[model samples]
Target: VALNQQPRDMIDLHARMFKKHGITTIRNFDALNDLRNLSYSGERIAEAGLHHQIVITIMDLPPGCEGAHTQEDYSKMLKDILDSDIPFHSVCFKDSSGTVHPRKVYETIQAARKMVPEDMILHLHTHDTAGIGISQYLAAIEAGITRIDLAMSPVSGGTAQPDILSMWHAMKGTDYTLDIDPLKYIKVEEVFEEAMGDYFIPPESRMVSPLIPFSPMPGGALTANTMMMRDTGTLHLYPKVIKEMEEVIRVGGFGTSVTPVSQFYFQQAYLNATQGRWEKINPQYGNMVLGYFGRTPAKPDPEIVKLASEQLDKPVFNEDPLDILEDGRPAAEKKLQENGLAVNDENVFIASSCESKGIDFLLGKAKENIRRKSTEAAKAEKIVAPTTVASADSVMGLREYTITVEGKAYQVQVAEGGGNPIVSTPVPAQKASAPAVAVKVVEAPTPGNILRLEVKAGDQVIANQTLLVMEAMKMESEVKAPAAGTVVDLHVSDGDTVQAGTPLLSLSS
Candidate 1:
């Protein structure tokens, strides 16, 4: 989905690149467990002389939510993989969310072992976000899983794969063995920590979240969502949004909570929380439920399907998603040529996937964004009240001035006769009051960064016409006019961050 060119071009490019980098194996899986989505890619990888590890995503749906991620669901996927005759050397039971129950993991792996050839490698990959990764891995090992993903400390143990040392320790005296040196791993951890000392590690990434099994968010997506919320000053809404995810997953057809799908669930949950429940449906969420991605494990709720159909203005589609997407190479090359860039495969792919930013990179217009720790400390400021204040010296009995320190500006306000500023009503200028006009102030429905303004001041718009676009939780939302009016004032501009109910613009009928 990140690539621009045709699927054929994208698959070929990636397969060749992975081989060039000495990668011998590629684990490929689709979020919806659609074999159709993985078939071509698997073939390409095998044709490229790389081992293809076809994957079936695994997760336990939030308790009381059902119809998918069952033993039958996994067996059906395995059967599909085998029946498709797609080239593969291994199979992976991957749970990015770390929400799979231990018994279910054991049963699935044991069952998979019996189905695949004896030589085929069976791998298990999961995170420790819910603090059950190690237990799940143990279950897999007992069920004859040959290989499992592991990480080292500092980066491990929280939202990452189970730490190698911890797993090694857990297997002590058991028939199974990790067979690695602890001293070497300690040194590795020390060096890794030193190398990463300058960067700020988000606290959420470092701590295990007990809520993962409940909401079932993947580790990578959880950190990403949290960081975006932190940047937009909406971190406080995270818990409420997470709580809202239960209903989204329960009703939205339980596709495995992995990327694209995971992000869709998260974005929808956020909207449901900030906006009224089901007030606004995320486009991707709407599309997924409408079967645009592929068949979800079970049928989605009919009410949600209807809501999505109406909101997205698209009918339900059940065909393979890959067959629906138009070939993008011709358009990509045309765009590259229009921009006077060489229409090579590399340029075409870049333009196709990266969109404008890719074009900017080709044209040398891309700006570098690098974050580094600041070395200089900010200096403190001391504020002192005036010894004697005159009533006429201040504007409306209040004083305002800006102070600059270390290249940063700080606005300061001083009140006259300030032991504590006394409340006083300001006198109005000696002028007649203006006539009252019917004006409507349009406020933001949720916190987001303003993407663009569709209607500027004095622009006449009809009711329900889009007035501005907002980016929230990595999704673009159109803010429409509530009624017909002329936009009289804009309180915000493009790229300004706004909170829920913050005034965005004013309209006069």
Candidate 2:
């Protein structure tokens, strides 16, 4: 379950619902850092008579010091919960980023097994992002971890959990065996592969990337960033962005690149590349630097911290960051009531936890708007041919007439025996080409939809100035002027589909 993304109240509500459905065990990923907030959640789960487990996400970066520091932190967090009368079933070492080396995984699991009680189960969860998930799992198993998380094929590799079939085969001759049939899983894989044929499935999502260990972008974030870049027509810059991310992660103290931290790193790196270095800092990054998200494995660069602090006025809270946030349920309930929506625990939870647009979609507001727009577009495109009235005379045999229909002149000839009428083809007028001049034609670098037009004809633009924005592969890219000149023509408009090398605009110096 997602602990970092939502509040304790929401989690409690979710736990109650899950318990109603007879779900006895719930594992919370990314749990160690949010202990204070999770304390109430744990109480609720225990109160509901449910088994709870917390997964401490680990990264083996920054080498020796961070591993030890994180292990200590995890030990303290586990001890705190166990001492608090909260009954937890197990603990997990989650290498969600797949950054942990196999040896490190073994060492960490070995240390953790000794630290926890003998009865307490140890679980291992790792992704195949760096293609070392199977090895890591093996290491964890050797270190006494019994429970391991694995996914089926199609959804099983790259950023996702390791493939269960692969692991099962590897363990076929071993004492630690899985009860399963390979054929059943292969059938499921085939169904998913067929179903996802139309969707954008990144190569990294299903294949090994040698660059992942160096880049260290989490699987989820990598997919998201790729789509974002594709939508912006800036997918070509992805490699550069990944390289920039390496430095960002390093300077930002190499915090486990997951969720809130991963997003922070991604946004900062994206802004650094697209705008300027540290020119646009996300507020969360500033909060992180100020110690709002708890302590980093390594301290952030003092220079970065100072710079971000100055920009954000350096608001630092010594205690848990959640202490500063006012409970949002009351406000959410009030807003729902004001909108004539039923003010219940579920609605309030959704309102408080979800974005306004998301709530509107859930309420069918967005869906209704889409249906209305579709209806309008359908009506606009409906073809309506002009109605014509004709009469034929046998004595005249045939007659020819010029008729005006729908403001267009049409020549029609009536012949004997209702023969088909022959119509003249209209010739479109063509204009002479402009005199040869030194002009620059800016073409689209990739296939995408024109998101916005920044300039129009007769407008003066400077070299490197953004001429327009295009979205491709789920990313946005800025189309810039090739040379300083007066805009002569625009070949594309907002929302127009374009192809690579398609002329977007023209300028004459």
Candidate 3:
């Protein structure tokens, strides 16, 4: 899969075979700013008696630096694509990695819908790769995406496919038809099992459902899990892919298959990682990593690449290219295999839940059954009927102690305090102490990971000056100084791990 390989070459590629098997309308996970050979491929498709639908979309933003500027740039790009008059049927903003902010998905879809007419599909494809695809899709639909694709639970990964049926049933806003018989779809497993004689699907890969607005069918022949298996040799590729993706985002470069959200997570992880440099990546590294995967990301302008090269260029790199194979180093292959998390099958459906997690839930059901059996056995033991105590105003009764209740613990306590000295009914305890000082003040407008740090500890920054850049779903976001002061306690630095509510940089009050 070299860049210069001809379309005829790709036709022999297994990916094309998947395409030939009733998967004609292949949508990219994300769109590249410069399609290396989309036109050529499209032409080849026509020659091959097939329609090649190449979706042209852009990931949202770079890692750092944000303004009305970045959005205006996206709007202009949309306009340019429209003016090109290329025979593209659709354009969309794909949140494939599920990294888009809910608000951004809403606004971006709304704005794009206004720019494109109904005939040219203005669509959105979000993946719950990071476990948030459903919410982001809901936001996009609310904003407007008439055409969408989802896996039936059988094919859906991470969780079930977007609950399309449930969402449709709940909102009633969309008027779309999948055109598949619901009853027939439900019977697919029986047919498949009959034909195959065995289920390839692990119990963990099975569908779990009704989590969202609507449920799509429980299964389908989709997902890139198989290629992910063949890619076992590219052990270092995952982290490298993450870093390269972030670098692309840093320079406004885009990919058709790698969504802005995916890039956001990749870049965000890269920016926060301890010690990897960009200069280290060369043609050899690219070949080992993305060269086999796809084109190395190119930028909006070559000048951006130059600027990035300046910041990232390092003299003494991590490892020598010649010694790459010799090093018994941090490799994804051994690591992933040791953990048994590396997926090694082409047909394996990565359900929305982890494959093993399904069995764990099943274990709960088994435990519940065991409890039922134990309770049934306990029915043989009877409690003595309560009797009045001889010559006393208060009466004490013997009660049966049954540990078996449905999946929960019994809380035994007397309503009165002090070791049940006085008999009384049990009561729930009042809540614990409240402390004002324990609460941390939240900086509004703070989004995902901090992308860049403009001001360091002890540096004086102005009230409105950018203190740091953060990113959520590939969109560049900013956090500015709250007040004019020398930075005091910089709790979190650039690339430091932090959650949404964690204190980033403490400013003097």
- lDDT (Cα, tens digit) per residue for candidate 1, span 137-252: 99999999999999976788778999998999889877999778899988999999888776656779878888888899999889878866765667899999999999999899
| lDDT against the true structure, each candidate | 0.80, 0.67, 0.41
Evaluated at residue 459, the lDDT of candidate 3 is: 75
Over 270-340, each residue of candidate 3 has an lDDT whose tens digit, in order, gives: 33332244432222122213222233344233554444444434222223222223322123224334544
Q: Note each model's CA RMSD in angstroms.
A: 9.5, 15.2, 21.4
Q: Name model 2 segments beyond 4 Å from true.
A: 1-11, 20-23, 31-34, 62-86, 366-509
- Please provide TM-scores, in order, for all candidate models, with all chains considered together: 0.77, 0.68, 0.40
Stronger candidate by TM-score (1 vs 3): 1
lDDT of 3 at 290: 28
- What is the full ranking by TM-score, best candidate first? 1, 2, 3
Supply every candidate's count of residue pairs whose N, Cα or C atoms clash at under 3 angstroms. 2, 16, 36
CA lDDT for candidate 1: 0.80
Q: Write the per-residue lDDT of candidate 2 for residues 369-475, one digit (tens) a residue.
A: 12232243343321111112122111124555656666655556667677786674332235443465666767665445676688998999998898997654333
lDDT for predicted candidate 3 compared with the true structure: 0.41
**Model 1 ranges off by over 4 Å:** 1-9, 20-23, 338-340, 360-509
lDDT of residue 242 for candidate 1: 96
Regions of model 3 farther than 4 Å from truth: 1-31, 44-49, 58-75, 159-276, 282-509
